[model samples]
Target: MNNKTAIVTGASAGIGKATAIYLHKQGYKVFAGARRIDHMQDLVQQGIEAHALDVTSPESNQAFVDFVLANSNSIDVIVNSAGFSMQGALEDVAPKDAKSQFDVNVFGLMNITQLVLPTMRAQHSGKIVNISSIGGQMYSPLAGWHYASKHALEAVSDTLRMEVKRFGIDVIIIEPSGTKTEWAGIAMKTLLEQTPKDSAYRDIVEAYADGSFDGFSDTPEQIGELIYKAINAPKPKTRYQPSFSAKMMVIAARKLSYKAFDRRLFKQFRAMISK
Candidate 1:
């Protein structure tokens, strides 16, 4: 029997929930957490341990780590999938809102990882799977803060990878593009609410909202499978792009000149909002 334990944050829905379930199926004891404890009853019913976790709170993070360790002796994997996008024009977003974004996306992840490291380091093996977005590599208008947070995550993850490698912990990043989840709707709603009615960015925000994500998105289950594949590898790559388009976009962002990439990206953004 495959006996491993995995911790998945943001397990109330979307990628985190899917990953928790997938890991369970693969014979790992899954401990899933999110603020929405009610939303995770389904996970509980399926034999995954679900707990209430406020990632932003250090107390909550410590408690979560304690609970998981109480149940399982070792934490073999930790998938940090608890993040949300704060979308709006940079000028329109309040500093507090931007800080909140960083709190959840960057600080929370870091905090949780810190709590788990002692256990992993003692065991001499563990996997840290961070669910980053292609936005970490590329950018769009009106999503400055969101992109910034992801960019920060990318840098932190890179540094952490080096820091933990000596201890036998693998830090892996999953950069998915659009996914079939409530995230898009929530992001759009936040964008509209954050932008003032008479704001100059209204047209762009509205148009961006109208654009459909059907063909461009992957299902949460697909990304979950990718995560499974990545962590299971004896020597996993530092980064995994779950979709072809996401890989291509990351390549473009890395290879193209700044101006060229910006122009190309803006053209696509214009097309998206124009439609």
Candidate 2:
């Protein structure tokens, strides 16, 4: 055993679960937490510690952190992956729901990070990997709130990276595209739920729902591998786009003018609905 400790949130399923397993295989003492404790039985059987965690709940976050600290001497890594995508036209999505998106993706993540920073600062070494999305770099229809949250996360990660460097803590962002997981289904559900049947944007929203954006979908394991690479690297890049399409989208967003990107995006949306 490496005896190095790692904390993984949202470990009941999807990329978070896969990441916890990968870290375990890499010999880190992994403590995995999620709201669904039953879903983590397999992790426990694999010698990983599993606990119930709701990132939005401060008490739960505190308890999870304490649990890990009581068992391990040091926190070497923390992969904050407990987030979901909410999709709908900005006007159509309920304001409260939009706030919930930010709560989980931005504020909740910061809450957990604040809890771990003291330990990392004292140890003078740690890795903070945030699982963002390609949407963080580019925008799309029916997902304004979700994209905004990711954009916020990206900006926060960048600022935190500079702030924590003095204490030897590295904040890294991972931008993944269409990773095969339950996230897509949940996002689609939100798209439909947020937009009414008689809504003017219904046609375009339905078109987006019917389409398959996962033609080149990556597996959760693949993303887990990328997370491992970032954590293990001596000097990892601040941002990582795990897939070719993600990298291209980020580059396009950076190189193209806002109006140009909008024209291209709308053109694609037009095509999607026409078919």
What TM-score does each of the candidates earn?
0.97, 0.98
Q: What is the C-alpha local distance difference test score of each model?
A: 0.92, 0.92
Model 1 lowest lDDT segment of ten: 208-217
RMSD of 1: 1.1
Please list the residue runs of candidate 1 whose C-alpha ends up more than 4 Å from where it truly belongs after superposition. 212-214
Q: How do the residues 19-46 of candidate 1 rate in per-residue lDDT, one tens digit apiece?
A: 9999999999999999999999999899
| Candidate 2 lDDT over residue span 1-275, tens digit each | 88899999999999999999999999999999999999999999999999999999999999999998999999999999999676888889888889998999999999999999999999999999999998898888888999999999999999999999999999999999888888788878778877899999999998998884648568899999999999989999999987888898899898999999999899989988999
Could you tell me which 10 consecutive residues in candidate 2 have the lowest summed lDDT? 210-219
Candidate 2 versus truth, CA RMSD in Å, comes to 1.0
Q: For residue 95, give model 1's deviation from the true position in Å.
A: 1.5
